[model samples]
Target: MRADRLVSLVLLLRQHGRLSATALSRELEVSTRTVLRDIEALSAAGVPVYAERGRHGGFALLPGFQSELTGLNHDEALALLVAGSRRGAQAFGLGSALASAMRKVVDALPESHRATAAGAVQRLLIDPETDLLARRTDTEEVPDTVVTEVRRAVFAGHKLRIHYAAADQAPKWRTVDPIGLVTVRGQGYLLATRSGSDRTYRLSRILAAKQLAEPAQRPDRVDLDRAWQERSTRFRTGGDQVTVLARVNPSRRGDLVGTALAVRAEEEADADGWLRMELTFQDSRHAEWALWQLATNAEVVAPQWLRTSLRDRAAALATCYGVSS
Candidate 1:
């Protein structure tokens, strides 16, 4: 761990040119004294690290000193290249940083592996704009400034005031204690609390944001995965929830389950290989939307209302195609 810290310290200086002990401590999650000691150690090992004394002075390396610390193998390099190709980083406002890091990773590689890794990355495509049906995946627009402020508040453990425009609701200002930020399916959300109640706000819905001077009212440390799971459970259970029983074609089982909130129960496949399952949805609209995607591959067996809705939709679709029954 100490070795990793030392290497990271060197890289930080190399990247930023100069940074104060306090900044290093914050970035490394260590203390200023520890940072000073690390600097002393780096210089002791002939790393050419030097300190400048003044209000603006900090630690820096000799001019044009680049560390040869590219310790990635071929597969590792390729993995990083593939990750860099993804569009997810743009959602969190880290596109430029990812690009810069990718460049450094490629430059650090040995000459023999560099060209091959670069060529291999060119052949891998990720998150293409259009699918097989030529349907485009719409990406939500998140302003860089909003994301930056929210991110700063999250990492610095500060309160945030946001003007959020919820769907079908007027924009309102709310001060929240931000716990963390999560991005799923190319959309970002701020997982936070308003008046000590769990609140999740879509980043795209946030029109304006500001980091407050007061510290955030949150735990000292957070387990984001567990927190997210708990929030998800509450969200799935609470809304206008509904359950539907359905018989789905075995081939399209995955398609149905993927769109559902949960599969409450699943029975063995019948003689004709149709799979019976109980599924949960946020509401009638959610169920209707998901089932429509499956066409004839799925049939809603229970809940007369959902079945009626599907039948009506089918009739409407048929009418559009001029089919008379």
Candidate 2:
């Protein structure tokens, strides 16, 4: 513990030239005496750590002492700069600190690599995703903050109380035992347990949240990765792919073929001047949904069930819209 405190004290002095014993103790989570002892140990190890016992003094490193990181190689220096830049130089809470830290890393790099790194930034324009990374100048997102806190709670085995927002229902507050954080494409999701049932809450829909220091016993649910995989597969396998064969009015053949959904059509001038069309969909639901749009323009000839469903839906719609069904 003393060695750990000593290392932390050294780093603190390197980052900050002077720190009071109380400050160092609080930072290292140790007693004031332990902080003094760590300073003595650093001195014993030729760390140039000095202590001043007075109303205005505590611990200070000798002037011109170089940080251990100051001797980094060119690539290491550039990497440090890249890491520092991620904290954001124009964003709140980290702008000035990140800028200063990045400057130090760039300045420490070998003269050869420094120009190359600078030139790369100048030559490249990283057009930030306007929709994904969009942020207001001052207003912070509560959902985004909740997502971050939920992730930390999941890792630390803690519970979270959240106010959740749903489009079709009233906003409600609930406690969730955080299980895992999933990133789908670019959106974040939280899988949690509520009242002994597993559920997923989209991070963007969480209105507010706070992590509870106390942890509830997390359930031995199915492995999250496998569960998600199975869920996805089940959804994709829900229905069989079917082909819809339709007879289109010959006058509509060119218009039908012009559409992306029109798969294939055979043009044979029947007595009624109609052409036959075929389209494929992963499930009947898609075919039915599309058929509702093409009423009168297309007539379903195969898959009697789909045709019946479409006709029933159309009749219902017609009744609801005050048309003679």
Candidate 3:
């Protein structure tokens, strides 16, 4: 609305005095012509706006003028409220601060925005305690000492040394330049660079950590989201991939696909009502493990070795149970 834009223009000038027409255009995301028109409108409305000339000069409001109208719009307020509802902030030790800020923001919003945003907040939930199956979910645990040291390096731009425990390996010390922290699905990760190469470590696998006094060698600015996305792509594509052709019960198809690294192809239900799926997993071990989870609900139809492996495992299990047909 022009009305809202006009109000925003006035507020922007009030907050940051002496802004050029071009600066106002950038701030308001409008063209300079629109800004000039807004300025004329404000002046005709008896606002105390005045223009100054020269290289460093721009528009400024009279010192004594002040406006009372201000508040976030419905979408903006709801976005902040929804973000605050997430549990990810707790890992960064901002739980109490986030709660406090959320209250203040809700209080400051216009009455309509407040009510609508509050209602929207209750309608959406992130990282709930239990999933659809009613099973409890728990986040990966990192020791306080490990979290604090890593957090310090990330915020202070310092190098960090940590005792990291990789899968099936003894803990080893490594020095890395701390970039930022990211949490997804309740698991925390430290995104960093080692010898100018990208590295990501699971926070729970950090046995110990120390913030080094030396400054970190990294770019002055970073887009953490882009960096995390790149790392995720690398992880998804770098593994020893094994594609599996399987037939699974229609109802349990989702369970089987969820364990795969990627689903290359899927077909409609066959005569028996079983769906045909072409799935890719990290490796043979991964493929074998994923299909095993569904038990009789899924069957491997290709990679003859996989069928034999499953048959042998079934035989061993039956023998161990001392069952005979």
TM-score, candidate number 1: 0.70
lDDT of 1 at 109: 70
Give lDDT tens digits, candidate 2, residues 107-177: 56665897788788878644343445575223223343565576567767888988998769888998989
Q: Kindly report which residue pairs in candidate 2 clash with one another.
A: none
lDDT of 1 at 296: 92
Write one digit per residue (lDDT tens) for candidate 1, span 56-167: 9999999978777645443234335436435667777765445445656766776589779978988978889789999987778899899889988998899999999999
lDDT of 2 at 169: 86
Identify the leading candidate in terms of TM-score.
Answer: 1
Scored by lDDT, model 1 comes in at 0.84
Clashing residue pairs in candidate 3, if any?
A: none
TM-score for each prediction?
A: 0.70, 0.42, 0.63
lDDT tens digits by residue: candidate 3, 1-325: 5876777777666656789999988867679999999999999999999999999999999995766645555433433543643556655544433443455455557656866897898898877889999987667767766887898799889999999999999999999999999888777899999999999999989999999999999999999999999998888888788888999999998888788988899999999999999998888898888988998998999999999998898889989899655
Cα lDDT, all candidates: 0.84, 0.65, 0.81
